[model samples]
Target: MPDLSTTYMGLRLKNPLIAGSSGLTGTRAGLLELQEGGVAAVVLKSIFEEEIAAEYDDALSEAARKGMSLESYDYYDYELRGAHVSQYVDFIREAKTAVSIPVIASVNCTYSHEWASFAKDIEAAGADGLELNMFFLPSDITRSSDEREKVYLQIVDRVLKQVRIPVALKISSSFSTLAQMIDRLSKTGIAALVLFNRFYSIDFDIEKMTVTGAGSLSSPAELAGPLRWVALMSRRVGCDLAASTGVHDGAGLIKMLLAGAKAVQASSAFYRNGAGSAGVMLKELSAWMDRHGFKAIADFRGNLSQAESVDPGVYERVQYMKHYAG
Candidate 1:
């Protein structure tokens, strides 16, 4: 049997498969089930910045409708903010006590603000690390790309100052100079970078004439995007890389490792198969390693990365002119 243990973001994982943030990791029962299913770590469901902002807005709107005095409105805002922070702290504490595996707290935000102070409470609640799922939709026609990219750095700087634990940033692949952007983020004292966060897609309901979400889960075929970048940037970035989005099985997990990812996060695979899918993937990983005559994860990890490949240009090719025109 080959050794499956690997370290990610300074946390020692028994295996590389971490149960990524989702509803499945939102409670004690979910955490316990994932642990039993052999996941190395769990990133709790993200506390959304928009959700907190929305709650405050709704509270103020309701108070105004009731003709509440200004004093009462101020009190309601304070109370609502406290309630949200308290609930998240309690959840983190409970999860830490319930499982032996590392529990990483996650915050999904687009900008840096006072809400980042909550990271202090999360560290105090005993989270092993923090994963910031940050993306600024560059939808504003007036906002330059430089202005949009600065938000991520600003948020990370503020959050890192607030917490003592290791921090990782989960990002999307939408930047114009993706490699430069990622390298800049890696230099920000972060412990790891999770490649390619999955974003919600808008689909038109032709008959209803309304918009709906595209499928909420990633498909197996979705692995290619992260795979390419991980292989390309793994040798270039300043920090450890963890592959996210579209990793569905042991094969997907193996591909990520060979492509130079230190770890791989899976959510949709468990949704489609079950939490036990984690153990199944690990089993397959171990078997493959044995057949390849590898004794540990480090033995073959990054063996196929772009840095190590003779034909590295294959990873840089984006046009299909060669294949299609032929």
Candidate 2:
């Protein structure tokens, strides 16, 4: 059998498929299921920065209404925040004990605030690694790209100082200078970078004249953007790269590996299919490897990246001029 094992962020993985951070990885039961389903690792459901702040504010407001003492206010603040952080820490401990594969704790943050310090707790809780799902939507008309990009650096810097374990940054490809940003971040001492986080899309409810959420799950068609960037930047970046979004099966996984991704993260596939979908993809990958006479992941990984491709321009080509003109 081909050696399917690979390493990401300095941690060894039995295969390249990772259970991306989602509700499916929020509990011990879910972690065990994914392990049994044949995933090499699991990124625990992210602890949202905004959610913690919002909940803290609500609790403080209720305390004010009750005319609590200043000391009581402090108590409530510590207890509320601790409850959230402690629960996540406890989950990390439980996940580490419950599954043999790596447990990567995720933090979804928009700012470089006190929450970045929580990474230490996550690390102390026995997490194999940490993934910062950091993004700041470029929606503020007054804010320049440089300013927004600085926050991402600040968050990574803060968290890096707080823990010794390897860290991975999961970011969106929304930056104006996408390639430059990827290169800059890769030099930040991070172990890996996960390309393209899937943000919640909004859709119009024409009948109700209100906005609603678009499909939260990614479709297979969504893989091309990350694939192109991974192929373009993998050889150039300082750290390893993992492909995210649009990966739904073995073919998608294979495409990413060829594009030079060290690993592939998937969530929608499991939601649309089942947890066992990972095992199915692995089986397909192994069969394809056997037929190709490849004995290990390293034998073929990055074989088609732009740096190694015969027609490197194909990856950089934006227009379909050749196809249309031909």
Candidate 3:
């Protein structure tokens, strides 16, 4: 039998299949189904800073339209941030109480300051770990890359100081020097790193002249991006890597692990295939492993990473020109 179990961020997952934070992970019943589906662990849906602000804005607009009195509006517009966070913390407590596997709490942050102490609060609520989804938009053309990068480091510092629980960072592929950035981030006492957060893009309808959000799931071809990066950086970075995006099946999951990922976080596949899809993917991987004569994930994991490979140039940009020219 293949020993599919692997460790990530100090947590012993039954397999390296983490159900990433999404609508699928928001409910207790949903989380139970995922655990039952043979996943290693689950990252709860992120508590978004933008969402809290947006909700307050919607409520204020409604109240203003009704002409509410100034004295009646005594509280701050976004005071519900902690209240919502507390609710999520309660959810974690419940998840911890309900399951024997690891349960990670996620936070989607816009900046690197103040309320970062909330991470410690997550640990207190019985969360086994934390995944910081740092959202740094490159909207300010005037901002130097140094400034943008510093924010990430600052976030790591603040959160580390705030929480004793293991921390992992989920970042987008927007950095100018991604390899350097990953190396730097790994030095910050983090337990693991997830590749490429999927930001919801805005789409405009020409007929209505209005902007709307894009769909939640990733297209099949989309898997290539994270697959490529994981293969390239598998042996390069200091911390363990988890592949996210474009992973919709067992083949994709096996591909990610073969590329040296500690785990694969998926969303769209679950959305399309329903709750038990994760189980199907695991079964697929297990069957493939048996046929291939690999007895365990560790037997092949990181075989292609820069850390263990014979030709490191294969994962470096130095060979890209040759491939392009050929």
Candidate 4:
């Protein structure tokens, strides 16, 4: 059998497939299932600063609606925030004790002076690594793209300085010069970059004039967004590339590896096919590799990249002259 073992984010994984951060990976049982199912590594569910803050906001509003005393409101607000962070701390500890696989704790942050302290504490709590999910919302008209880019770089430097473990950034594809951003971010001494964390979108029920949350899952077609960039920048970037979103099967994993991805992270697929799907996926990949006579992942890794492929323009070309001809 070919060597499926590979290094990702400076950590060795049994294979190239990782269980991405999602609800399915939030518990000890789920983590064990995924690891047993053939995931090389697993990124725990992200602990969002904003989500923790929202608990406070919701408490305050509920207190007001109930006509509560100011004293009670203050007590609830303080208690909620502490409980949130403390729960995350406990989760990290339990998860570390539960599994031998690399447990990467995730944080969804914008720019927080508090994150440095949080990163230090998370590392202390037994997390093997940190995955920071960050992006500047385009809805902020006051901030220029350059300014937003500065925030991301600063965040990277701050957290990296605070943590001893390897750090990987889960970023949004919201930059004006994405190629430049990847190049600069890679130089920041991080271990890896997870392409494009999918943002949560909202939908409006126009009939009822109400707003609702969009579905959390990503479709298989969604992989194209991250796939293209992975192929283009994989060879040029400084650190390892991990493809995220829309990876549902063995074929998708093969495509990512060929595009120079060190590994692929999957989330939505487990929800669609259950945790055991990873086992099935690994078998399929091995079968395909055997049939193709490729002994290892490196044999054809990045074979489709612009720098490595015969038809370089196919990866970079946006317009076909055939379609534009008059």
Compared with the true structure, all predictions reach lDDT values of 0.92, 0.93, 0.85, 0.87
Model 1, backbone clash pairs (residues 3+ apart or across chains), number? 0
Which model is ahead, 3 or 4, in terms of TM-score?
4
Pairs that clash in candidate 3: none
Can you write out model 4's per-residue Cα lDDT over 7-70, one digit (the tens) per residue? Answer: 9888988889999998877999999988878798899998988887777788899999999999
lDDT of 3: 0.85
Against the true structure, what is each candidate's TM-score?
Answer: 0.96, 0.96, 0.89, 0.90
Q: List the residue pairs that clash in candidate 4.
A: none
Candidate 2's displacement at residue 150, Å, is: 0.4
Question: Residue 307 CA error for candidate 2 (Å)?
Answer: 1.2
Query: After aligning candidate 2 to the native by TM-score, how far in Å is the CA of 6 from where it should be?
Result: 0.5
Candidate 1, residue 217: the lDDT equals: 98
- Measured on C-alpha atoms, candidate 4 has an lDDT of 0.87
Write down the lDDT that model 2 would get: 0.93
Better-scoring candidate (lDDT), 2 or 3: 2
- Which portions of model 4 show Cα errors greater than 4 Å? 56-82, 320-326
Alpha-carbon runs more than 4 Å astray in model 1: 65-74, 323-326
Stretch of 10 with least lDDT, candidate 3: 70-79
